[model samples]
Target: MSTVSRAPKRSLASRLPVVHQLQQSVGLQRGMLIAGLVVSGVFVLTAIFAPLIAPFGFAQRRDDAGIFGAQQPPSAEHLFGTTVGGYDVLSRVLWGAQTALFVIVVSVILSIFAGVLLGLVSGYFGGWLDRVLVVVCDAIYAFPSLLLAIVMSIVISGGQSSLVGGVFAAAISITVVFIPQYFRVIRAETVRIKAEAYVESAKVIGASSNRIMFRHVLRNATRTLPLIVTLNSSEAILTLAGLGFLGFGIEPTAAAEWGYDLNRALSDVTSGIWWTALYPGLAIVLVVLGITLVGESLNDLADPRLRGRRAVAQSAGVVAETSVVPGGSLTAGPGGLGGLEDGESFDEHGIETR
Candidate 1:
């Protein structure tokens, strides 16, 4: 008796959507996905462990010796040099990551929940509510996102910037802009799915409207959400940065923010002090690039028209299945299966007709 070895089952984590995509991707797709993940992962880890990784507190201006002299160049003591305010540039960057992460979580969560729910309701029940929502979303879309965010931040915080208040200001503002995007995507999907045969069947079986909507429609409608989520996360980061850069962001004492750092570093750039702006600017660029790459790769892979799969090589031992005979014609002697009619097919043995 011959024994066959069974392949090991993937763990739940490996079967996760992004992980599964990574595993299934080949060649250039795989490379892009992996690179994005690595960059994103480092940012997340830096945020999580900022307290430990950073050499000093975000607001620390002095060590055991004395106050770090303002605009100090990179030295053995301070790696990335000191900011114009005498803050350690490296520590500020690390803590800024945490602040950025918090904003991203807050914005994406609120937007997804509010947007998805509204979309489902609006799409399933096409009435005055749907039209009203569509119009509202279109109006919101008319404004530039950063401009809207700035207006919202002023309205929410009244020009006062603190840790919690500033973070929420940025989050809520970004959420408002993103809700329309999610709503439109989900609503369109729901409208299409509600007319599917299975949905009609469910209705015919006397299923409750809520059950039909949630049990059948909502789950299928959300398959496209992850791509949007990734893209929006990146957008949220940019919006937060914009808010801070525009002088409506968190204070240095309350929390570190890359945008605020850049704002503070503006004068430094003119004075030929490169260190203050370079690192924080790079942090923003890299995090955004990582997220954008992930979103774009997944978007391409999900669309059949754009997805590129590696070509498979044929092995000499594995003969391909084909309908063609050696002579390129199926005519056998005087009578044979002539390219098979609708009612005829060859049997498994490759001889008898069935």
Candidate 2:
């Protein structure tokens, strides 16, 4: 019996990381998750194949005398249209996915590294260091997200023509905004988890603080980070767009960026050049929506109450019977209501009769 019980426990421990236990936990949320995966997968593929699938180079212009002139409407020659800058809108849109994915990946990675490090230290050691870090994080968190991004943009790029600088500026700014959220979540969990018996046992066994903090505490505390990461990736795209809209985006000649295109298209609306803005805007909206749906579904998956409800719903066909054991406390049994002893009597109804 002991070996059998330990076998199940070991299997459960092995499966936690490898299996997505929450994938089928709920119907509506799982559907949203599937939809998000489909949308995100398409964008990811677009990013990977931007160079090959895009009909034109990101900044390719049509100086050749043909139907592919500057600002031409969508046609066979220019599938989406030609932009005011003579670039192919379809190619630019496709390439923009690559740019967006890069920014999101870089920002989220940097933020997670910094945030998790600070969170682990602050949470494990509750001294003046923790207080100072907490105060600083809160102060930064108070600033409006876009405003903070703008400040970081100017600091990093000086509104310069460097493509790499603009990308880093946007990524770092998003990182700053995201770090505090990760820090707070991780810190709280670490504080609670550090007091558990296993953690105490590690301390008692002469484990170094560093080992226990990293090996034990950090692992358990960061369980929710996947959800945060998905949500933050979506925000990073928006922040990158805002930076571009304000003219702090990547240089147009160096890369195709959705936000920069939208900025250039601001005046085109008056002249009825809707294609320039519409496609990029839709790209941003759909990507963000897809990411948000994935994040929300992940949140639902992480919730215990939802999981319990889902388990109950799944087992609805199996009736659970409450019975009184010999000790007189009510307990569950496979058979129907079982409070009766050997001599107990019942009428046509299930009620007991003296």
Candidate 3:
């Protein structure tokens, strides 16, 4: 029997190029990853334990000095101070955390479900269904998101202005605005990935269109989805805040909404009680900024071109030289392996000749 020569085994480091590339990306540093995790953890924990974490029940109010001391600067007694309604501002703010988290979670869930479903259908079908969704999405997109939300709020409940009504209105409006973005992004990705070898192979194997589109195609196509979802949640929060600021969001009488609270304090800016508006507004900004930073870092990690620059730089450090062999021929080896002579094999062992 003839001897068999085995091919060299690849090292684990060389097997997963995408992972290596991701590690080399900007903002994929250990510090950024830790910061992102911390932000996400805090937001999630605040949402989950809002009742236990808050100093007072969101809707509960007492007829004590706390309510009378409206606009007191942050102190040991009141962390965020009191509002004009003899309500504890700190309590309201803490309670508002629940509201903000609720809105974000609800709106994002709705948006992602509707958006991804519509996107997959529009992309995969690409006919009258696509046209219909595109037109509807475009119409909603044409109206400014905040304005559309305000109009929707007014239309849905005949101007009820209740917390539940406002939340539902905001959810619907935000979902509509974001659906088009998701549809477009997913569609573009689908269009490219449908032509890939794996997709084509799946089709050839008699897999159903829905299976191929959802299980095979979408899984590969949604590498950017985490970042998209993060950014959209941030946008939803800002839109909700803007509606509250404009007097179209949660009702003023409701427990404590950051937006509604900010609206109440608008007139007091001229007075020395800047803390009322300032603290809530700052809360909105900080939350938005935190989400934005995490989203940007994820984007960097997902983008291959951005991630591979460091790998390319490292590759440039090592070099191999080549030279011509004897008898007017060329070959490649470390410091030059000579060209094969006549029928001789390139290996130095000469086992083939033997």
lDDT string, candidate 2, 1-354, tens digits: 354444433455546631364444567776788888788889899999899999888878864664457788999888788888888899999999998998898899999999999989999998999999999999989989899888887787776656677677778878888899988998999999999999999999999999999899998998999889889988888998988888877888868899999999988888999999999999999999998888888788778887577778767734444334555555423334454434455666656666
Tens digits of per-residue lDDT for model 1, 67-146: 99899999999999999888999999999999999999999999999999999999999999999999999899888999
Candidate number achieving the greatest lDDT relative to the actual structure: 1
Clashing pairs in 3: 67-86
RMSD of 3: 9.5
Query: Which predicted model would earn the best TM-score?
Result: 1
lDDT (C-alpha, whole model) for all candidates: 0.88, 0.84, 0.72
Ranking by TM-score: 1, 2, 3
TM values, all candidates: 0.85, 0.84, 0.76
User: Clash totals for all models, in order?
Assistant: 0, 0, 1
TM-score of 3: 0.76
Of candidate 1, the 10-residue stretch with the lowest lDDT total is 310-319
Score residue 64 of candidate 2 by CA lDDT: 61
Pairwise lDDT winner, candidates 2 and 3? 2
lDDT of 2 at 119: 89
Instruction: Estimate candidate 1's alpha-carbon lDDT, on a 0 to 1 scale.
Output: 0.88
The better candidate by lDDT, 1 or 3, is 1
Structural RMSD, model 2: 6.1
